[model samples]
Target: MHAVLKLSKYLKPYKHFAVLAPILMILEVAMDLVQPTIMQKIIDDGIVMNNTLYIVGMFIVMIACAIIGWLGGAGCNFFSSKAAVNFAADIRADLYETITYFSNSNKDKFTLGKLITNLTNDVEMLQRALNMLLKVFVRGPFMFIGAVLVVFFTARDLFPILFFVVPVLIICLYVFIKLSITLFRKVQEAIDGVNTRVQENLSGIRVIKAFNRMRHQVKQFTGVNEELTKRNMTADQVIAALMPITQFVVNIGIVLALMLGVVKVEAGANEIGVIVAFINYLMMIMNGLMSSSNVLIQIARAIPSAERVVVVLEEQPDITNAENPVKKEILGDVNFEHVSFSYNKQVEPVLKDISFEAKAGSTVGIIGMTGSGKSTLIKLLARLMDVDEGTIYIDGFPIQQYDIETLRNAMAFAPQKATLFSTTIEENLKYGKSDATKEEIKEALVASNAIEFVEKLDKKEQHELTQGATNLSGGQKQRLAMSRALIRKPKILVLDDTTSAVDSITEKMIQKNMKELKGSTKFIVSSKISSIQHANLILVLEDGRIVAKGTHEELLKTSEHYREIVATQVEKGGILHE
Candidate 1:
């Protein structure tokens, strides 16, 4: 309930519709309540007295009431729909924004599958609940209470049947509500499990196919699907039993009411029309209770969804702009002073007491074996994750003192795995700088050595790439990603194995182009010795420490690890240093 209440802020903009919907629903219910009384009048005052004029007058009035009821119901539905859709839209927008701004650790904590489920499936549940609130939730109680009030005024004796029936039905509903809450939570978990499996499978489809694991994948998916189906069926069975149980209790009340009515009529305690109207009121009350039960079932399901959404909404990002942010432009120089970091506090640090400096406009190369913290170091420099100890500075100021946007805008980074959206080549490049002109985009492509193949295509930069850039070659994707980073004209450029997929000739050409880009500091991380040997300063990393920091000529003579790496690559004839 608290979680659901938190979402009420979303209703502020649509409060007018939210308020109007219930008002219209009350009018509709009032119209419905009057119809039975009018029928009673026609039967007793008109038909019994053979007064045709009175009967026509009552029927016309009843028709007008029915028309008004129709209009009121329509108006209620219109307002309810508008409020519900806007509420959902606002939540989805906020959720997307929250995700986009999440720090690396925060994102890691939530995980991709859970976030997707919360945004899509959970938000949908809340939307349905919103619609139900203004529709049946309000109308149901109004009908139930109004019927009871009218029956009490017209036939006080019918109260006995309600007293006997309502308590038993309430007890049954309470039990169903309790049981449904637990079952619905399991249903939502099953949905998350299914979504996780599907997301994993889709992302690794190529690996599954390459290893001929299609049958294994199918078996794994079937397990989750069956679990989801079983849980849903169990929940549905529990909810399905509710209607029959409720009906049995209401039917007994109906029988009792009829017996009492018959006796009253015979004893001249109540008129036949009054008895008929009382029975009609009893049915209306039963309909209202049943509608309320359905809404409760929906609420039970929505509770878990609401909790999930609240969890996302309430999360505060660990990284944010400083209180007094500085927006000065970066000068390409970077310094790390006694920096250390760990993904988790309980675990050993990934990077340990890492300290280095790269002058503006210099090429700094980072080479390490797998798990040596090459990527982690880059992440710290970009402020994607903060250091466990010490500080990283851009130019002369600590990176934390700068506004986050300005700090990030100063550096352009390309990761080991190149990612491209499902869009045109020009649009992908512009992601680095949205306002980049045609000439700047062409220059970026030329610098990255991507213009060769791009010019061969009829569409050139307009060529559309598929999801994950699967439509393009691995080398082609790398070039496009590099072009995207270069187009920003950043003060500092970080490339993490960006050219590993391309041919050696193309890689050297890219290296040549990097040297030509004046005043831009470059940090290149690669496994290939050839890629980093030309740097003004090369840092050979092992177990998160700088094992050697020197130019290629100095490292070859003084560092055994650097010598071994060069010897290994040269023995394979894969690379050679000039």
Candidate 2:
């Protein structure tokens, strides 16, 4: 209920319609309540007296009330739907915007499957629940209360039936709601599990096929699907008993009312018309009770979804701009001052007391075995994740002091895994520099060695790329990623093993071309020593600590790790000396 209140702001814009919808529903309930009295009047006054004119007039009044009820229902439906659709749109847009600004660390807090379910499934559930709330919730209460009042004023002797039946129905509804709430939450969790399985299988289908794990994957999916089905059935089973019990209670009340009415009529104490009208009101009350119970059950089911949405909406971005942030051109002079970082505080640090400096226009090389914090070090340089201890500076200014976009926009980073979207090659290149010209694109392609393969395609730069660049080979994808970084002409360029997939010859060509790039300071993280041997500075890292830092020739003599790496990759062959 508190979560519902939090989201009430989404209804603020539609407040007029929101207010109007309930008012119209009240009118519909009024029309419904009037029909029973009209029926009683037609039967007792017109039919008993054989008054044709009176019968006609009563029939005309009933018809007008029916039309009014119909118009009111139609208006309520329109406003409810309008409010629901607009409310959902607003929430969905905000969720996506919040996700867009999420820090890498914040993103790790929620799974991709869970987030998708919140955006699509949970939001959809809220939309439907809001519609029901506006329509059924309002109508049920007004109709139930109105019917009760009318029946009491018309036939006071039978009001005890309402007392007995309504209480039973209320008790049954309470127990049903309590049981269903827990079950509904489990049902939603089961849905997340199913979605998680589907998300993973779809994303990793190629690997599943390559490893011949189709049957195993199917078995895993079957387990999640079965859990979802079982939970849904459990929720349904708990509430399934509700309808029959409610009907039995209402039927008993109606029978008692009819029996008492018959006794009163035998004593010539009641008219048949009034008794019939009382029974009609009782039925209306029964329908209202049942409808209200269904609406409450729907509300119970949607509560989990509402909480999920609120979780995202309430989340503040872990990384945000500081007040009065400095926005300036970075000179590419980067320094790490005793910087240390960990993905989580409970775990061992990924980078430990790491400190280094790269002058403007110098190439700083990083080499380590897998999990030596090579990629983590590069990410810290780009401010992707803030350091847990110490500080990093660009051009002698603290990285945090600068505006985030200003800091990132001045640097170009090609990650270890090359990712390309579903679009034309030209569009992909322009992602780094939106207004890149043909000549600049050509220059970037030449520098990255992507121009050769791109030229072989019929469309040249216009060639379309499949999702993740599956249409291109590994080397082609790497070169294109590199080209994207290079086209920006950034002051700082960080390539995290971007040449791993390319052959030694192409790797040499890329390195040579990058050396020709005049102003950009480059940080290259690579396993192959040959790739970084010519850098102005080379840092050998092991177990999250920098073990050696010097020019390639200086480290070759002073560091055993450098010597071993040189000895290992020397046979693979590139010139090792200046």
Candidate 3:
């Protein structure tokens, strides 16, 4: 019910459509209701009396009613399904916006595949449930209760029989629903398993082909597919098995109604037409109950999907900006004071007691061996995750004071992954500045040394951007990423090993480009020893602590850790550290 109410916010905009569809559904049900009474009239006034004109008249009335019923049902279904689809689409867009604003502290709860499933599969499930909401949810209970009440009121003698059949019927429904739900819940998890498989295969197709794992991947997929089939079959079988039982119960009621009606007719207490009409009502009531029973199946499927969506929507972000959130207005003065952090405290802290301060528009290079917490420092500045101890300030204000969007916009981040979407080169560059002029985009590309190959392509920025930037080489992708960050002109730019893929000469060229950014732009460059050689300030970290901090010259003279790092890089031909 809470999920349904939560979704109503989207439905409010289409309330007219929602209302119209249900009115039509009620009209359709009304038409169906009149059919039994019409049949009684035909039997009593026309057929048994051999009145030809009365017979023809009632037959015509039935045909016209049937047509109106069909149109009403179809029109209602059309509008309702359309509204449900549109509502789901609106919610999907909102979910995406919400996801984008999520702090990184909460990212671990949503896996990439699970997130995709929520957007596509789970939203689709909600869509189907909404469609059923308009039609079945309307038609089912109305038919059930209406038929039951009509039977009880019009044929009071037969009403007593319902006490026996109805309870059995309800019990049957309860048992099957419980069993089906168990299967349904498992089936949804199986869908996630299969989704994960497909996601992994697509993301690592290159790896699979390179390793000659075609048969192995196929075998793995087969296993999950088979499990899905088993779960689906189990749910359907449990559901299907109950239908015959329900039918048998209906048959029992029909026989009992006929027996009592005949005994009354023989005793001259009831007319033949009344007995015939009485039998028809029995069938109608059973049919209506059956329709309502199908709703049980829908509720079963919706339960698991609703639970999954609720998990995400109910998730408490590990960190969230405070209400009437504090605002920070800064031009890139960053401070990290005695900060500590861990992805999970069950594990060791990824960064511990890390402290540093950089004034506005100064170049701060972070140098370290692998996993030395250099990248973790920049993430803290980005406010991706909050520190458990002390504070991180930007321009004299704690970052937590700012809303997540404001904090992220204050900085640009290009992590080691060098991610680019399957879009035009221009679109990728415009990610930095959506309204950037063509000249500015071209200049950023040139400055990052990526303009050469970009121009070589016949379509240039208009050319197709292949998946994973597969159309370009590694070095080209890296430079293109650099261009993306540089184009943003943000207050702070943190590059986590942005030059790792390019050659020494090309790396030097990009570094020179970054140096040109020195006093005018505040930059935090994280790299192996080679990339940060020219920074005004450098921090050399060991494990999660700052073991050394100074300029390259000062560090070399004063810190043994810095000396060993420089010596190792020099022996490895300077650029080999990447």
Candidate 4:
């Protein structure tokens, strides 16, 4: 509940709407309260006296109150909806913005499916709760208190019936709300499970189809779906029971009032008109109590949602720019001094005692077996994840001294698994350098060997891509991803096996083209020795450590690990023994 209140700041912009909603709801409740009194007038002064004119006059007054009440209720709905919708929009925007800044380590704390649920389902739950709170919270108490006071003043004898009814209703509400809170939390967790299953299935649909595992996927989805349904039913059943219990208690109070009224009327202690009006007020009291119960139920459901949203909102990214960070043009002189890192401290470090240097305009190649920290090495240089121990320097100053944006902007990384958005080829390339000209776009496409296929498309560079570039071949997607990175033409270029999908001939062609960027320092990580054999300097990694370092020719003679790799690739006929 405290988490929910913390989000109240999102409502600041909509405070006017929030204020207007409750004010209108109060006016509607006041109008509703006037109707029972008017009914009393029509019955006693008009019907009992057989005066048609008096009855018509009071009936007209009731119609006018109904119109005013309708207006108030309508206005309340409009304003409340306005506030709630805008409040959700603002919170969602901030949530997304915060996620964009999250480090890889920060992202590890949340799964893709859970974050999606928090952004969509959880935020929606809070919006609906806020809407109900604005309208019902104001109307319920006012209606309940107004009816009680009216009954006391106009029909005192019937008021004692409420004393018994109200306490029973309050007790029932308290017990049901407590039970509901626990059930609703489980319901939300169940929703997260359903979302996670669906997301994983959809994202891996290709793999599932290739492996002929459709039936298996369906069985998995059905299990999660059933869990969600079961939880929803459990929570709803508890809420459903409350309405019946409330109705039963209200009906018992109505019977008591009726029985007591008959005695008073027969004794000539109260008029029949007064008894009729008292019954109407009793029903209003019942409605008011039901409304209050509804408000509390919404609060119960919203608390869990609010807590989930707050976790995201309050999460501080492990990586943030230093205060007064240096902003300078990166010269691409990179150094790592005994840097080491582990995704989880409980596990062995991914990269151990990594020390290396690459001067400006030089090419450094890293070749290692899978899981030898090849990709993690480049990610550290880009500051995607900070090293747990030791320091990394760029141009003599610690990388931490540079503004995070400045450091990242000066480097362009093409990851092993290419990621492209659902946009035109030109638009995707522009993501790297937003103001890149058409000529530069063409040059990058040519350099990455993507131009030939792209030119054949009906829309050419304007051709739209499906999400994740699923419409393109694996090699094509990698080429386009490389083009996006190349278009930036940064001081430092890190290709983390970006050419793995391309043919050997095309890979050589792309590497040859990369050499034309003489001003940029390049780091290439690949498994194929042939890919990095011509590099100015090469590092052979084993496990998480650099086992050997030298040119391909130097390492071939000096390092047995290098000789073994060369012998293997040579036997496979992938590379010649030069």
Full-model lDDT for every candidate: 0.90, 0.90, 0.79, 0.91
Model 1 lDDT at residue 279: 76
Ranking of predictions according to TM-score: 4, 1, 2, 3
lDDT of 1 at 513: 88
TM-score, one value per model = 0.98, 0.94, 0.91, 0.98
Q: How many residue pairs clash in each candidate?
A: 0, 0, 0, 0
Model 1: lDDT to the true structure: 0.90
Query: Per-residue CA lDDT of candidate 4, range 461-543, in tens?
Result: 99999998989999999899899899999899998898889888888788788877778899989888877887788989989
Candidate 2 C-alpha lDDT tens digits along 1-578: 77888888999998888888988998899999999999999999999989999999999999999999999999999999999999999999999999888888777788777888889989998889889989999999888999999988888888888889998888999999988778998988988898989999998999999999999999999999999999999999889999999989888988999999999989988888989999898888888988888889988998989988898888888877889988988889999999999998999999999999899999999998899999999888777889999999898888888899999899998876888989999999999899999999999999999998999999999999987788998889999999999999999999999988998788888989988998999999999887888899999999999999999879978999888888877766645433
Judge candidate 3 at residue 217 and give its lDDT: 100
- Put down candidate 1 lDDT per residue, 404-447, tens digits, no spaces: 99988988988879999999999999999999999999999999
How many residue-pair clashes does candidate 2 contain?
0
Worst 10 residues of 2 by lDDT: 569-578
Report residue 318 deviation for candidate 4 (angstroms). 0.6
Q: What shift in Å separates residue 197 of candidate 2 from its native position after superposition?
A: 2.3
